[model samples]
Target: MVEEKSDRKKTNTIIFDASKKEPFNINEGYKILHRRLKNSWKVGANRDAIRQEILRTCDVFVLAGPRMKLQDSEIEALKEFVSGGGRLLVMLGDGGEKRFQTNVNTVLEEYGIMVNSDAVVRNVYHKYFHPKEAFINNGVLNRALLECAGKRVDSAQDKRNSQGLSLVYPYGATLNVSKSSVALLGTGTACFPLQRPICALNQRQNSGRIVVLGSCHMLSDLYIDKEENNKIQDIIFQLLTREDIKLNQIDAQDPDITDYTTVPDIGYLADRPFGCLEESEELPSDYMKLFELNLFKLDNVTLPAVLESYEELEIKHEPLGLIRPHFESPFPPLTPAVFPPQFRALKDPGLELFDLDEEFSSQMERLAQLTNKCTDEDLEYFILEAGEILGVFQNSSVKRQATAVLDHIFTQVCEFKKLNQD
Candidate 1:
């Protein structure tokens, strides 16, 4: 059953599994790709174990490089979620269990897809990084949908299309789709000079759909925007924004959790060891029972105070002549009151600053592109420049606003650092 959240309108909700020990998560490189999709749908992580109630709330479910096997109940929940017209995107890598130990094949077998245990390598047209960086030169997007996208199918448009477009498959496994499945992208005689299926889509029941990709890193933050990997983004866009799928809010409670709480205590131990096993002695069961009985008695009994007369204690306050020193803050001082017009006024400089605006726009565009693949040092350098730009502005309020934006980006860097630590 679907229900709307009181805070916002109901849209498609794509839940990425975090409970299954996935290598990729929102905290990592997938942050920006998800940020780009914020306008169309609600994308978030599922921290709790998968259950029927949780699946009912999600429009699309993703299991990417899961390192742990799903419980029996979770498997049933997933099966029911798909049978009830939900969409599932399963991503597996070439090394499979050897790398992540996530045996997703058990779930894929039920859907008529098999994840090969071997990695797909291309010695001929591989990326400079490694030979395993395979690229698909003849990927077929839903051919009919390509025409439906627009009238003029230019090179840029063709790259977005699923039909006859070469896409970067990267380090992934080759797939084995069933007879009813449609091959989205083929190996194209690149990996071992033998064609194989890399991505497959299957239609189950009336509205159910399942897309299996052999590569988990294809849509990751690092590779999603690389070479031909943008095609994967196009595929994701089509999947989440499709008009045929009906989206609903999940409102079911997790059955695994309960109200009752169990508190463990050292009192439950029969004996305590000091030096070695021979030196340790076991407590008498009767004495332990008596001790527990006393514990309960103390909960209900409050002993009287030793003093007969109750008196309030007073604390003496001593004023120490503490020296206060004036220290300069790192941030610039605010001068909004001195120049109120610059801070509060909204005036369009218009074409007067067109040349400057064009230059600023180009710089911003370049910064955005660099943000996707830039190193930590590059981000720090740009942030320093951004701070300098803010300092150049005469208006204190404008500088404050720009600082906020820079701070937000800095938080993203901090999150990246924390993820790396984990």
Candidate 2:
């Protein structure tokens, strides 16, 4: 019973690596994956350097979207771990190693799997909004994957059918797989880099296994539940942990994938254009042949023909004269009026409109006139006008009201009274 427990512990333990500052972890971006994994496996994170001691305790080690560079020792340790019946799962995002600033390819390339530095994008808009969320409708490269996903795999027709398993590969790149590895999934015809590998598996006889995925998001909380992705995840884990599921040797040998072809950047080529030189025609032995005499010479070759035509028609052959054209006037010509010219009188001087007495009046005289014009009913109006004439309202802080005007006047009177008493 104790041996069975130890075997169970060894079989179900999965260690997610975080020593390289990976983006996903148990308590963070991988919550859904953690929850799903907790039901059957013992999941945890490794925050220290990857060593054989730690790898010996777990059956599978997952490196999810690591953004930091791996040490040489760590790479060697992982290689040794995988060679000794251990499973290794490495997941990367779009832009691959250069974008992530890591040297994970040092380890992946050893197994004939290298994630390309290009992104996988959909050519048309589909259920997902982002173009990087490539929806591959027929990307199953190996029939073994379909069989493991509980899909019916017909040996004849369903190998490259449109009704195969689909996946939403978000923010992912493509993989360049070689003969040493088996391409399991690919970016189908609907995506850019058409029919290229996105997931690859490498297993040796009586040795460890390694699986490389182009997209780390496929098993994250955001996309793990998406179309057939959960099934794909199950298939990946099954391939790694279980030995009953075997890859089809025929499909593994020749995957339905196209070669990685690069297209020239049109914008770059347009910016730097090269001119082509053409071979000039051989010059003739005579230099006179280079210049054609009929190109620009003034000639009167038709003059004689014109004179014969005039004599044949019995017409006068004289120099043509210009005839004066008489244009009818639309209206009678205008003549100056037979009367003395009249000019507009200058406008009357504005001085007559202004009263000199009022214009040059002192403030006291204006106040006196305002007093005469107002009565008891205009007491508030009279004070306001008197204050304006005395410039009491010049200070903006003083309110323009009857009480304020009266207060100003009283304050000035009090100051004058105080001066007299002193």
Candidate 3:
């Protein structure tokens, strides 16, 4: 059911929009980022006809859409474009209330990728990634795929699915990667996985480079900063052009997606809050100092001791002005505030304390590590606390606190599941 676009010759600009659904601010979003009525159309991709227009004519198919059951022809067109060397950028979401999972990943599976229908990737509150209500995380783009994307907001909030993840704010989910030319930028002892933004980042045997993410709204003018959304924009540019990196256009859609029989439970990652860390220049130097303090009890100087100092660093500025100054706030009321010392206190008391800053910073780092590498013993204690905290968050106005509770739940639950099954 593909809609036949007016075969417009001006295909060079770009085609951006959602599946013509109610919630997606796709068109307006393009206006904000590109700052003009984009040659982009605000059509829907979830249906057959619209999918045809997008999958066929659009040079780079940019999407931040609700769940869509792909039509066969549209799927074929997508494969053909990629096989013939066209680029695509799709941003799947937790979806609107009409929420039914689509198998976009099944088609990509032939190319060594898979996007599950029910499983939605959620982000935890933190630095480096989520800054505003909408924010961009990170990715390893195939140089050939991301060459065109100059800059675009990478992640945003879901008015419907406000289920915040705890691993990477506005970003969450599991990613098991093999080896590829995919180059990820960022450093830390442990690496976080791409939950929603997972597809576009993977490479398929068909030779097309895919740059996936946990959420699509990550790219919004509401969230864009000169330095932050590069991962999304870079890949956007890469999908529009070729020869920058090695890629193949796929002709046939992955057959598995078409089956529509296998979708199961929705929640794929652990049930608890996924703890995370994100960095942005707009916020206070120690904006994340509290999370660090609340989790591990170490100071910044000591915890990030191995990392470079924020003082020596300079963040890239946006031509349009700092992206809505999210770390600050769009709604005057949402501005982030320093917490009362006790309110920000660590949930557990086992860790040793050092200097004020170092104590908190060290604790945050350790807690991050603990979440990443939780054990049977840790799970027992965390489970007890998670139940209590979940109740607290149930009546709370704060989301970060909710995220902290979930982080512990998932980590502990993971251990609990493994142990019980064993």
Candidate 4:
């Protein structure tokens, strides 16, 4: 029972190093990874400096996207821990050590694994939108990885069939794996750095192992469950913790990977151009003879021909003489104010032309004038003019006729008589 408990303690604990201010931790960016690892492993973080004592109880020590540089002592402690049969997993992002400002390569260089200071991108747009979110469909390098991920490995087909597993490698860099290390994953043909290594593993004879991944975000909460990534994570943890899974010897020695070739920055080169120098024309022995002195000279060579053509064209070629110009005016010429200023006669005032007597006359005077102006033949006309003068037509709504005016006046006279009677 004591041996059983010892074995459980040795194989169950996984420590995430946070001493270097790593971007992913147990409670932060790696929450999903932490929960997945919680079922079988005791996952925790070491906030203090990494030392031999802190890593003694850890079965797997993870350094996830360390943004700060690791001290020499801490690096030495990690090396010692791995050499003592403990497994180590180191993950970094694109732009590698220079962008992260970390010296993690100082330790990884000894194990024949170094993260490149470049990024992996997709040449074409596929499952993910961003170019940096490189979706590699055929990136598995070793057949053992297929077996660990429970994928069928066909030995009858070529080695390319081993790339059946797919994963999304987001914001990742590439890796340089030496002969001492085994490359496990590549960027595939679709990615920019075609078929280059992105993940590597190095195992010593002492049963100590180390795994380096290009991107730490592959197992973060945002992308942990994306396209067989969880299975890849399981394969990685299984390789580190369990001893039953073994890498294929032939694939480990010579991985299906291409050389890490760099592309020149065309934009940078285009900004600072160096054009080819054009050759000049060969000069004569006497440079003074080359100058055409008559090029700008005002010569009279064409003057004689021009004068001769004037006679043939029946035109005069004598010196031009000025002639009197006749200026016609669009309007008649203005005469002086000699005719003693004939001013326009004063305009009549806007006042109405009316007779004072007619305007000031009362209704009875107007009726008397109308009666005197009319005879028996003009009686109706006189009545209408009188009604207009007395304003009877304005007081009633009837037509301006002699009978209507008479009727209105008679109606008023009856109403006045009735009032008197009452």
What's the ranking of the predictions by TM-score, best on top? 4, 2, 1, 3
- Please give the lDDT score at residue 253 for candidate 2: 94
On a 0 to 100 scale, what is the lDDT of residue 111 in model 3?
Answer: 52
For model 1 the TM-score comes to 0.51
Alpha carbon RMSD to native, model 1: 30.6
* TM-score, per-candidate, Cα-based: 0.51, 0.64, 0.39, 0.66
What candidate 2 gets wrong by more than 4 Å, as runs, is: 1-11, 155-157, 160-162, 274-422
Off by over 4 Å in 4: 1-11, 274-279, 284-422
- Tens-digit lDDT string for candidate 4 (208-253): 7899999999999888899999998999999888877778898998
The candidate 4 region of ten consecutive residues with least summed lDDT is 1-10
Alpha-carbon local distance difference test for all models? 0.64, 0.88, 0.43, 0.88
Full-model lDDT, candidate 1: 0.64
Q: Highest TM-score, which number?
A: 4
- Which run of 10 residues does model 1 get worst, by summed lDDT? 248-257
lDDT of 4 at 40: 93
